[model samples]
Target: MKLFNIVSKTTLTLSLILFSQNVSQTHVYAGVENASPPAVGKTAKDFSLSNLNGKQIKLSGELKKGPVVLLVLRGYPGYQCPLCTRQVGQFITSAAKLKSANATVVMVYPGTAKDLNTRASEFTRNIKLPANFQFLLDPDYIFTNAYGLRWDAKNETAYPSTFVIGTDGKVKFAKISKTHGNRSNVKEVLKALSSSS
Candidate 1:
C-alpha cells in the first residue's frame, strides 16, 4: 500500500506539471496564431499610440494628409538593434525625398511598459527626426500584438516590419523581416509612396 501511494503521488505531480506547461503555452500560441499583418490590398487598421513626447498619433489622422509609412522596430530587446539603426538612418538620409513624396513616416518602438519611454528616448537621442517623421511607442506589446508583428522570442520585442498605407487607408506596400536584417529600403518605400499617391 505504501509503494502504491508513492507511485500515485508521483504520477499526480507529473500530470499537474504537464498540464500547467500546456496551459501557459496555449496562450502564447493563441496570440501568434491570431496575428496577421494587414495584406497589401487590405485596409490598414487604425490605431492610436503615444509618441515619445506624450502626444497621441492616430493612423487615420495621418492618412488624412496623404500616405503613411509604418516602421516596426525591435524596441530595446535587451539592447538597441543595430539593423534598426541602419534602416532608420537610410530613411533619415532621404528625408527630403520622403517629404517630397508627401509621406508621413511613423516608426513604432515596442517594449514592456517598464522604462519604455526612456528606452525610446535613448534610441533617438543622437538622431534628429525630420518634420515628416514621428516616433511612437508601443507599451507592453499592445500595438505589436495587434498588428501580428510580435517576435515573441528570447530577447526580442517586435519584428522589423514596414508598411506604406495609401490615403485610402489600404496598405500599398508591406515588408516584414523575420530576422534582424532584410528591412525595407528608403528607395523602395519612396517608390511605393509615389505609386500609391
Candidate 2:
C-alpha cells in the first residue's frame, strides 16, 4: 500500500508539470497560428494604442487626417532590436518626404506590459522623431495580436511589418517579414504612399 501511494503521487506531480509546460508553449505561439496579416486592398482594422506618455493614438483618427504609415516593431525582446533601430532611422531621415506625401507615421512597439514604457523610452533615447511621427507602445502585444503580426517565437516580440493605409482606411501596401532583416525601406514606403494616393 505504501509503494502504491508513492507511485500515484509521483504520477500526479509529473502530470501537473507537463500540463504547465503545455500551457506556456501555447502562450508562446498564441496569435500567429490562427491568423494572417492584413492583405492589401483590405480595410485595416482600427486600434488604439498609447504612446509612452499614455496618450492614446487611434488608427481611425490618424486616417482621418491623411494617409497612415503603420510600422510594427519588435519591442524589447531581451534588448532593443538593432534592426528596428536601423529601419526607424531610415524613416526619420526621409520624414520630410513622408510629410510631403501627407502621411502620418505610426510606429508600434509591442511587448510585455511590465517595463514596456521604459523600454520604449530607451529605444527612442538617441533618435529625434519628426513632427509627423508617432511612437506608440503595444503593451502585452494587444495591437500585434489584433493585426496578426505577432512573431510568436522565442526571443521575438513581433514580425517586422509595414502598411500604407489610404485615407479611405484601405491598405494600399502591406509587407510582413518573417526574418529580421528584410524590413520595409523608406523608398518602398514612399512608393506605396504615392501609389496609394
Q: Tens digit of lDDT per residue, candidate 1, span 100-152?
A: 99889999999989899999999999999999999999998888988999898
Off by over 4 Å in 1: 1-33
lDDT tens digits, residues 1-197, model 2? 99999999999999999999999978865764566678999989888889888899999999988999999999899989999999999999999999999999999999899889899999999999899999999999877887888887889889999999999999999999999989899999999998878
Clashing pairs in 2: none
Query: What TM-score quantifies how close candidate 1 is to the native fold?
Result: 0.83
TM-score (C-alpha, index-matched) for candidate 2: 0.83
lDDT of each: 0.91, 0.91
In model 2, which runs have C-alpha deviations exceeding 4 angstroms?
1-33
Looking at candidate 2, the ten consecutive residues that score lowest on lDDT are 28-37
- Candidate 2 colliding pairs, count: 0
